[model samples]
Target: MEEMSVKTGVFGGTFNPIHIGHLVLANYLCEYGGLDEIWFLVSPQNPFKQNIELLDDNIRLEMVQAAISGYPRFQASDFEFNLPRPSYTVDTLNRLAEAYPEREFTLIIGADNWAAFDRWKSPEEIIRKHAVIVYPRPGYDIQTDVLPPRVKVVNTPLLEISSTFIRQAISEGKDIRYFLHPEVYRIIAEKKLYQK
Candidate 1:
């Protein structure tokens, strides 16, 4: 008999600092969903959000790397950085599928993102091509009825934290030590990021 292949989870995000919330969702998906490994696909630039004050791609990648360092199953990927600007999910998925033929790719996204799925580039194609694992976010409710066939909504704990809130706190000179990894927090403070 041929060896069975393991399913891989693709968790894409800006990962400004890659807080505990992100880690928790990834861990829950990997453990409960039987995912082989979770890759954190760091976006160089998020088209939906303005990037005038966003951190450098390498800096965000470094933070994600530091946050997920010890986890063997968690990987920080810079695939989007290498791809063209304004990276679209469909394009990324196509490239990834072509690059890794043996691995199965599942799209991991928050329920809030799912709510705005129609706004994404080639949203229909994305749903048709890969499995979507939607995790709960604070204010967004999961509407599985509206999703396509391949999407699976996971009832994971909703984390109240967000990178936007963290950035705001940092800009206001408030401590966000509890929201991020110690090393990441230290790096942000030392680098004086988000402070105008």
Candidate 2:
């Protein structure tokens, strides 16, 4: 019998400092999204978020590595690093499909991103080529009726945390123990990341 390809979820993000909210969402997606594994596709540069200050790719990657260390189902992928600049989701998915033929990839995105999905590069191709799992964001509302057949909305725990919030807290000398995994927090503190 031929081996079955694994159903993987492509959880892409900047992960400036991987925190508890990211972990929680990834975990929930793995369980509820019926994904065999969740790969964290760390973006070197996001076109839509270009104005926001970003940390070095290596530093952010290391923190993500530390954050997902113990989770067997979680993986950190630097796939975008080898690709062209201005990392786009469609391009990443296409490359991943060619590179890992044994794994089926699904794009994991927030409700907010889904709202603006049509604006993304090759949005139609993305929907036609792969599946997308949409998770809720505090302010954004997802309209499932208008989405493509491959798109799905799943109920996950509301994690009211953001990397921006954590970075600001660090700058203000506020405690962020509850916001990030201990290992991830340690890396940020040791490196004095986001300190003003």
Candidate 3:
């Protein structure tokens, strides 16, 4: 008899500072998404976006750790750190499958990302090789009627919050304590992160 593989949700992002919105959605997925665990795969940077204002890779990773403090089902993965720069989704998924043979990794992304899925590197191959779970975004609408066999849309909270918002608020000296994990907020406060 063979051991069953863990159903892991790969939630990749720069996570400039992991916020409560991130935890809320991931927790919902862990309980309702039929996932055993959710890994917050901290990417060195997003290839699609400009890499102008991102914090240090290790700093972001530490903030992720602080955010997921008590959640056993949540994790912070720096797998992309060691890999070559300009990390592509297809490459990450393929490498993850090859490296972690014991875990069945499913790519967890937003409907916004799904809308631009075709533009990603080897989109078809990503869909064919790995399971994808698309969650709702505030303004993004996902068409369930055209979903592929391995792709499914899960109804999650439509969070309007983002790291950009948090950063802007902090730079303006606004109180954003409720938006982030307590310890993460502490780190920012103590270090004066994002302060202008």
Candidate 4:
């Protein structure tokens, strides 16, 4: 008998503080996208964004671990931390292939990113290396007809919640506890995070 291959979804983001929206979306993606597991790749650095006021890398990674701790199909990855500065998605995917040769990888992204795919570092190379599954993002247009053979769009829900909003709310002295996982909120409260 042949060995069964595992299909892992690579959902990369700077989860400064993993929240309810991220949790709900990953659950929906796991069920709807036919994924065996979803790895939340916590990037310590994003080339596209300013890192000002961003939480420490380890703290952000810890929040991710706490958020997905109870979910069997969910994982928190600090793989990007080992990569070079300004780690791009393509870099992580390539490194993943080298590190986890047995597991097949799928790149999960948002429709907004799909719209700006061409601007990424070697977008075509990424498509050639792994399957790309894009979930809907509010107000972003994804033209399904022109998608590549390996590129797919799944029916994941739109969770408008964002880490930025939660952080800003906390800074302004609002109790945005409902927007995050209980443990995540607890961790933030204990650390006095984002109190500005």
Instruction: Give the TM-scores of the predictions, in the order they appear.
Output: 0.91, 0.94, 0.95, 0.96
Which candidate, 1 or 3, has the higher TM-score?
3
Candidate 2 TM-score over all chains jointly: 0.94
- Per-residue lDDT for 25 in model 2? 89
Each candidate's clash count: 0, 0, 0, 0
Tens-digit lDDT track of model 4 for 44-123: 85556767878888999999999899999999999989898788889889999999998899999988899899999999
List CA RMSD, all candidates.
Answer: 1.9, 1.7, 1.5, 1.4
CA error at residue 78 for candidate 3, angstroms: 0.6
Question: Across residues 1-196, which tens digit of lDDT does each residue of candidate 1 receive?
Answer: 9867658899988887689889888988888977999999998866667777778899999999988899899999999998977888899999999988888899998878888988999988998888988887778777677667889988887778888889889989997698888888988988988886
- Model 2, span 1-196: residue lDDT tens: 9998899999998887788989998998888778999999888865556645599888889999998999899999999998878878898999999999999999998999998998999999999999999999888988878878999998899988888999999999998787999988898889888899
Give the range of the ten consecutive residues with the poorest summed lDDT in model 1. 45-54
Report lDDT (CA) for all predictions: 0.87, 0.89, 0.92, 0.90
Residue 24, model 3, lDDT: 91
Clashing pairs in 1: none
Q: How would the candidate models be sorted by lDDT, starting from the highest?
A: 3, 4, 2, 1
Please, what are the lDDT tens digits per residue for candidate 3 over residues 56-115?
889999999999979899999999998877888899998999999999999999988999
